[model samples]
Target: MATLTSTSVHTSNLFSREAIAEGTMAFRFTKPAGFEFRAGQSIDIILLNPPETDEEGNTRAFSLVSAPFDPDLMIATRMRDTAFKRVLRDAPVGMQVKLEGPSGSFVLHRKAEKAAVLLAGGIGITPFLSMVRQATNDKTQHKIYLFYSNRRPEDAPFLDVLKEVARQNPNFHLIATMTQVAQSKGEWKGETGLINEEMLAKHLPTLQGPIYYLAGPPAMVAALRRMLINAKVDADDIRTEEFSGY
Candidate 1:
């Protein structure tokens, strides 16, 4: 991705705060321009550094966690890296960050409306968070299923939010899987395994009327696409976003 270089900022500061869990911080941001976005789309973040660049330059991409219908633009960072961790933990509120987009085609199009299956792993849950949130807010009529794979319950983002949305909407189903449950917090009794075709079939039996939206590491996304195709899903019905070289 090309860096956006200019002194001007495209959006205003709506939120600059952190939500903490499992020693990780998820940064949230918002702006007023009506902040229009499709449910599963993402925005490129252009962090300004007083003209200074990071070890790999000054910009990165992040998926919006807040619903498009919501009044704010939201994104969460894991705070795992030395550089990002410091910024999320210490950055003061009201600081300006450069941003562009609300871009990407991972959003659910109308043609595959009867059913939609969303697969996410770890921080990849960000985009689907927006999709499910928007679906509930708008009262979408599509049958939506979420296959969220995390190391443990504590490792996934927005557990309560996803549960709440699933509770309110009959068309929405949220299935969470933990790859390493032994190291997880107590009281964790969800599905345990990797997100592969067998696990997907167990939770989401059929993709007959559903279009699949996948986002995660490059290998995960690519592998899941192949799984869906092998399961008889149309190639065009699967959309994805892989956050590689980050």
Candidate 2:
């Protein structure tokens, strides 16, 4: 794995906010001049004047959902009733936020000869969304296969955007699975059940040289990692990031 270097802390004013899905909000902030980060990187954000604090502290790390070329820095997170999240979700425009270090090794391998398989669960889709958007915007020729899982369509963030991206980018493919198919409201026409070896084999043309990326809750990440290893995937070719809590 590669090491990431830390940069100077910067303060950014909140530009805008919107509810992207149920209990989830996308926050856009002014990007500090000269600040740059690779797709899939995350930053530490601190509410300048939070209404309250707790054992979780005032700062939270979130993956950058905005593309590198975007003028504003953006992140999406589930709006739990926690003190930190509550303050973030209710903060108004022009609120100043402290941002520190854009650091992470979970970025795409631009020069890889094989295809990339991205496995995301729930809100874990944030980083992969960043990578896919960047790849599409830059017109990079990296072949990407994203397998995103959620309980319901309403709970999945960026579902519509990702579907549109796949439609426009020939090199990118998306396979969305719903674990709670019984709860589906309408006629759903996509893969169902948790991602497993059979599902992978059905979609992946050949798994010979593909690299796998997994992101989600701790248990989900661990389970997927083991599943990949059991399928004879090289350990070095698998990368993962665990999103602990809301």
Candidate 3:
């Protein structure tokens, strides 16, 4: 993991934007010269003199969905019906925003020999997406297994992109499952139901050697941590980050 000496702030303008998933929007910004960050890091985006403000404030922190190797800095979020998102969603192409960070320690372990099992729920997949993309680009030898879960495929961001990444990286494993396939209009033949001990055992040979990273709603992260502990996985092998309000 790459640690930094200090945090810096910069002004970046919105250059492009798109809807990555249902009710989710990804905004791309100009990467200030010399601005650098490791995969799995997060940043805070502050609205500059927005047309309106709310109790939620004008600043929001988001995981860097784009990999370090990518040319631009990018972040995605669920477009909640709030003043912040409203202004963000409607902001013009050249709208400028304040950025502060490259924060959070939710990065990959250094041991390449040990496998990495990433458990991502909903938008929690953002950071892991960067990690996997970087791993593929760097040709890292670490085995990566991403188990991304959502209510349905439509709600799961970057699903197709992950599939392509898996196809390109031999060491990357992708296990995408949905909790509510019936509600989805698209057909899915992949795994269904919540990820559990049985589900993990089915794909992984032995869970003891792998380091687990969990990201999701607070409740989901807590539940997965408990499941890992109950399954005899070492406490030291587990790391967690809860994603909320985004």
Per TM-score, the best of the predicted structures is 3
Model 2 per-residue lDDT at 190: 94
lDDT of 1 by residue, 168-192 (tens): 9998999888898899766677788
Candidate that beats the other on TM-score, 1 or 3, i.e. the better one: 3
Ranked by TM-score, top first: 3, 2, 1
Scored by lDDT, the top model is: 3
Candidate numbers sorted by lDDT from highest down: 3, 2, 1
lDDT of 3 by residue, 111-166 (tens): 89999999999988989999999999999999998999999999999999999999
TM-score of 1: 0.87
For model 3, the local distance difference test gives 0.91
| Model 2 C-alpha lDDT per residue in residues 37-69, reported as the tens digit of each score | 888988889877687889989989888899888
Model 3 error, position 187 (Å)? 0.7
Better of 1 and 2 by TM-score: 2
